[model samples]
Every structure is written in structure tokens, then in C-alpha cells.
Target: MTTTGTIRSATGYLRSWVEAQAAHRRVPGVQVAIRSGDELVLSAAVGVADATTGAPLSTGHLFRIASHSKTFTATAVLRLVEAGHMRLDDPIGQFVPELEDGGSPIARVTVRELLGHQSGVIRDGQDGDFWQLGRPFPDRSGVVAEVLRAGAVHRRNEHFKYSNVGYALLGLAIESVTGSTYAEHLQASVLEPLGLTRTGAEYDPARAEEYAAGHTGLLLGEDTRQTIEHVDTRAMAAATGFWSTAEDLTAYGAAHYLGDERLLSDDSKRIMQRLESIVTAYGTEVGRYGVGMALQTVGERQLVGHSGGYPGHITLTLIDPVDRLVVSVLTNAMDGPAEDLAVGLVKVIDVALTPRTEVPPPPAGAPPLASFTGRFASLWGVLDVAELGGRLVLIRPTLTDPLPGVEELEVVDASTLRVAAQPSFGPAGELVPVQRDADGRVVSLRFGGVTSRPVDEFRRLRSGMTHLA
Candidate 1:
């Protein structure tokens, strides 16, 4: 998504690069969606949704969004609090009486502890092999039985301990208070209110054709994929049993922002997204967690959402509350780079929206410089020649942090330029000449005694390099 232009044009460029990245990574399939407030700015999918059947992916296809289910569960809990049905500080024993009867330490943990992962509740059950499909996920009876056998791992509010079982207990609490199943309560109270028609609390066999098949590689160097079987999570579904599409997920994410009356009130949203605890598992770069959503700090933006890791599917939904921007990425492969893809897509949109500082120095700009701006490639990799601050610079677009190699392009006549700003690239005034085509358009560029071929319609963006020369 390198080429700078209008958001629509930039999104068009992003779609092609995303498809190409998915192909290069050998991901079976992927779907991505970007939103500006409530409007869907970009929604695209590529590759096969089902590797065995080779069905192409669609933007509407469902993905098992794993732990993203926690966010919905959290939302449902907050709605109950809004209705004055229950308070965050309510003790679990008040609702799920089984806890007190079973003599579990979890009984002492407050509802707020469970919501913020401060309950120190066991993540899954004893022998949580259900994650690998070796055993079925626990039912309500099984959950209660586990609570009886094993309780909280640490004192309440001791640390940030992520617990799937904690959410299951919250589900039980919701059911006990509302006199309805967690799924039914969530549907009537949360999903429908947010207009998330494509989202489901549990896997629906009737919609099997629309669901993406999940594939996992059990061991290292295992390029071949093994399809993960679909099963009901039952009680634990509140923690990991949700399915959704990227477009729908982003729309749902947008509802959590302020000014969106479709879901939580601004006060409730603040309660949900308030950075309750910082996760030690993740460094400060990812920030902390608030209620069910994971808060990440990217630049000055506070991106909040949740990530889901199912056996065969990996998904992510991040929303920039300050910008009212949301990005969601879903993949069917277990090793799919959904987080990276989502972050990269967000960067692309942010760059496209911001005004470019480099506008080509004065005059109407040299005609030949237009040819110099296309991406040049070679056996080593790609060399991105673009105008930055009215000066041309070569950059490598593939690196996660790509500023060290930036070498400014100083115009020397129209066909030749000098690589400035770095001595390791060659001498400061190293001469680089551009080759032309029969149409009198610049084609290939020669640098460091090597002639590099330019790729047609290729764009390399380096706005992150603005701090450098």
C-alpha cells in the first residue's frame, strides 16, 4: 500500500499488496476490514477459505474469532451493570452459588476481578487439551466440577493473569442473574443491539458452508496443514466460541467508541476500556488491558481491541479511539500473521490520510523525476526511489523498521542523481544514472556499479522515516 494518494486510491493499492503478501506467506486465506467511525472504508479478502475444497475467500465468510468472544462477554457484563442488574464489585458467590458450595477460592474473587483478569482464576481447566481438539471443551457441569477440584491460582487482584475459566464464570453469573442462557442473553442484549448479524456466540452447523476451515501445523517445518475439527465449547463458549467476519468485527469494534449509541454508553465504554492492568506477558509497547479489550500503544495512538487464537484460525480487531478508526484481520491458518497484517494496514491508511511533507521542490518539478519514483528491484531485494520533502530517497519497504538504509536522492541533471545522507551506501556524492525507454520514460536505475530493474506500478512508502534525513 505504498503509493501515496487519496484514501480510496491508497486502499486500492493496499488490497493488491495484501493479496500478494498472503500469497507469499502461503496463508490459506485472509480477510481484512478498515473503518472510519461507522463507515466501512476498506473490506477485502484473498486466497482459499477452505484449502481442502479450495473455495475462494469472501469478505462475508465467517471466521472462528476465538478469544475475541471475551470482548462480547465483557460487553454483556457491562450492559447488565448498566441496567443495575449487577455491579462490578459483586462477589461471584452471589450469582454462581456453586463456587461457595464447592469451597473454591474463586468464590472470594469479585466480578471486577474476573473482568480485569485480576481474579487469578485458572486459564482453562485441569487437562485443557480441548484447545488441541483432543477433548471437547467443558460444559457447565464440567466447569463447576473443575471449580470444585481447582480454584484460583493466586490471591485476588495479585497480578494480571489471563483466565478463560474466569470468563466462563462470568457467563454463569450472567445466566444466573438474567434467567437466560449466556448465548440468548448476549444475542438479545448485545449482538442484536450492535447489528452484528454475522456474529454468533457458538458454531452453527447450518452455516458450515459459510465458515472458513481452520488448519494447523502441529510441529516445526510442518508445511502441510491438518484441519481442526469444529466442536461446541458449551460453557466456555463465552470465552472462545464466537465466529465473525472482518467487516462485521470492525463495525462491532466501532460501537465501543464514544458517540456510538448502538451499544455501550460513553460511561460504560470508559469503564470497559479503562486500562485496568498492564500485562507482563506483553511489554509496555503493547500497553495494557481494560476489561476484555487489549490496549496497545502504536505511536501516540491507543489501539484497543482483542486478539483471538483458535486452533485453525487467528484473528485481530484493533480500534484507534482517538481517530475513530478500526482495523480487523482474519486468517484461517494457525500461523497466519493477522496482527502484523492489521497493524500494517492501519499504518497504510494513516499515511494516506496525512498530508505528504515531500511535494517536489519548486518549479513544476522535472518530468524525468516521475520515472525515478517507481520501485526498482534486483536479486538483492527492492530499492524504493520516491520523493520525500521534495527530495528523492531510496528505501527498503519490507523491513519492520526501515529507516537506517534511507539514502537521499539529489538530482544531478534529469537522468542522474546522487545518494546522500549515508556514507555506507557508497560515497556521499555517489553518482546514480537513470535509464530510459523508447517512450522517453525513465526505466532502470544504476547504483553502486549495478543496474537495477524497476517494477511497474510499484510503490514504496516510508513516512515512518520522516524523522531521518
Candidate 2:
């Protein structure tokens, strides 16, 4: 179990780092939510919802959490199984008999195989132009045609092969078994039961302004990104068509924790989390997949969650079942750093929870820790000083991952911080002197001989500097 103190302290540092990193990466918008044990520790949003309009983003903004739809689909399937409506070993042809007519290899694909991505179904079919917005997403008839059109590209259970078509078939199966649409069934069975009001199986145009507009990536030597319109996924809502906020996503992740009976029994969760396939790309092991969920190893902790990649949104959610910790990071950009941000949150929490035995006390007349924290810059790069778990740490704001080679600092006096512990190459035992304005605002700080000014002041000074011979 994770202590509340640990999460609260970690989030204190994480909030500042998240805000700075989004600015540094030039990401259009980012939404993050963290849950530890039974508490919602943090909910934060940074940057703008629309780059063109510069609409400020909020925690309530919804993002297209693409492939994360699979997790919900899998949960729905398991619920049906619990009710004796379906079984994992059931063949697809039993529910959709039309699939068996064309000598399509998918006719024999089992529910379990599809759930674990072992069905050998073609990935989005040959004409997956819908992904690139060249055409609209397929309808139910089109999805069935896509499955029959390509059939199986590999032997069933040969290896893990991700297939959006496969999951779309599962959605159809759910609809057939329940006699309801996929969206309606999922809403009544899953989202409503979980009380997740901000989540939906597909895009809803009625709530347009509530959604954070997606943006194209910085592509083809273009620095500015254009907003992408939201489109209904049609028949493929199960595989890659879900919209949610970070807050709601974390709540959904929490219900997946082992032994939690809110959704499924422990027996079912064990099966869902059991390793079913090793996801590989280019002959190298990339990740591990279970029945709908993704498993990851971060430091010594094991996490289960999913990542999503929609047209203009990138999102990731990670859950530490043992500690009962959940984190979700959603971004409205084609090249959002959602995974890295989530991993950084985990690392920061780990650091906060790790016991420290040598923290020095603040010197007399020292400036408050809050007063010394801000983003500082130099010709080298940008760095942030943040107070984490009652201690101060200096982190590089420009790095995609924020935790590597983090430096700890101790209060020295009203104008200084002592580098307590850092990498050997860093200024580990030196004093960083602070310069302040008459209003008690930090103007600059010097690490050893190198001076770092407040980011705003540094930019202003650089703009006025004269060229030297």
C-alpha cells in the first residue's frame, strides 16, 4: 500500500515539472490525473486546448484516447462471460456467421485469441486510409468486409499481432450477444457502473467545446500545427475510438486493480493481467500484453495500463496495482509525450518515497523553499528547482524524461543552496548563490561559476545582447 504522504509530496514536485515540460516541448495541451490508494492526489492541465484560438485548457477537457478502447471492450467481454452470455473460447463465426463464407481465416479466431491479440487478424486491413483521414472510418458492413477482405496474415497464435479489425469484431460480438449497440451496452454496463461521467465510447458532437481540439504534429518542416476535427469512428469504436479525461481514466484504471470486485472478480482480473503475449517490433521485444491491458516494469514496480494514439491526440494510463496507484496523461498533439510524462510521474513518486537519511536542516534566516523554486535558464539549457516531499531538487526541464540525473539541494542561507547529492560530474558539493530583487523575488542563481537567470529575464537579456567579435 502507498502512503498518502508519499503521493502528496511527489505530486508537489510533479505538478511544477509537468507544467514546465509541456512548455519546453511545445506541446499544445496536456491533462494529467493521479490517484494513490483511495485518494485523487493530483489533477492538472497545462497549455492550450486550441493552438489557433489559444483557449486555455482545463482538467475537464476530453481527449481521444484511441486504443484505450480495447481495455473497455475487454472488460465488457469479461462481464458478459461472468453472466454466462459468452465464453472466451467461443469462435467468431458463431456470432457473425457471415464471416465464415469467404474462406476467411478469422472465422476460427477465438474470443481469447482476439482479446490477447493472437488472432492473426489483419491490422486495420489493407485499406486503412481512415487512419490518415483520407476517408471516413468504416461502418459495421465495412468492418466485416475488411475482415473477410484480408483474412489472417499469420498463423493463429504464432505471435502477438495487434489488430484493430479483431477488436472491432469483438465489439460486434458484444452487440450481438447483448442485443444492443456497442456504445449503449458499454455505457450501461461499464461507464455508468463505474460512475465515469466524462468517458464515452465515441465522440459526441453535442459536447464539442468540452473537448480539447487535437493538433497535427510539427511535420514537414512546419513549426505551427493545424487543428484536426473530431470524427466518429463508426464501427471501430471498440479498438480505437474512446474519448476521456485524465481524471476519469484514472478512476477507470483504479477499478482494474487486483482483488477489486467493483468490475470483475479476482479470477477474471488475474486472467486479464496474465501474460498472454510479448509484443515485438523489428524482432526486438517492445512490450508485454495481456488480455486488453499492457504490462510494464518501471524500476522495481510492475504496472498494468494502456496507451492510446488517435489522429491528433496521444494518451497513456498506468496503474501500480500493488500500491494502488494510478496515473493518466493525455495530450492533444500528434507527437505528445504522454508515455514519458507518465513514467516521469512514477519515477518522481519513487524518489519521494525512497527514504533519505542525510537531509540538512535549513540555515538561520534562509529564504523559504517556495521562494527559491522556479524555472531558471542559461546558455546551456533550462532547469527547474522544485520542492518535493519537503526537500528541494533541481531537474532539467528540457529533457523528455525529467528524473534521470536529478540533483538534490539544501538550503544554505537567504541567498544560497548547497548541492547535497548529485551525479559525480555535477557540482555535487558546491554552493549555488541566489540573487534577488528588492521585492524578495529571485532574479538569478549561480551554479559554481555558471550563472542562471529567471527564464523571462534571460530571454529579455538575450534579446538585447550585442554581437561580439
Best candidate, lDDT-wise? 2
How displaced is residue 376 in candidate 1, in Å? 4.8
Clashes of each: 1, 0
* Model 1 C-alpha lDDT per residue in residues 1-469, reported as the tens digit of each score: 3222244555654575576567657889999988776578689999988887788899989999989999999999888898899999999988989888878888888888898899988889788999988888999989988877876687898878889999999999999999999889989998898788999999989998888889884357666776777778899988999999999998899898778867788888888788899766544543489988888876557889999999899999999876788889999988998887887766655544542233324234556554567667665566767544334656555544334445666776667777664437464558888877888666778877676676542223233234565
Where does model 2 exceed 4 Å of error? 10-12, 355-358, 363-367, 421-423, 437-440, 463-469
In candidate 1, position 453 carries an lDDT of 71
Candidate 2 structure quality by residue, lDDT tens digits, 1-469: 3477667867766888888779877899999999987789999999999999999999999999999999999999999999999999999988888898777778899999999999999999888889879999999999998888776888899978989999999999999999999999999999998999999999999999899999999876678999999999999999998999999998999898887889899888888888888888898999999999999999888898999999999999999877799999999999999999999888878766763335588886777888998888887788788777667778786687666657788888878888876457778889999999999888999986688898888988775544653
Per-model TM-score versus the true fold: 0.85, 0.94
Candidate 2 has what TM-score? 0.94
Give the runs in model 1 whose Cα sits over 4 Å from its true position. 1-6, 281-287, 354-376, 383-397, 400-436, 439-443, 446-451, 454-469
Give Cα distance to truth, residue 123, candidate 2, Å.
0.5
On TM-score, the candidate that comes out on top is: 2
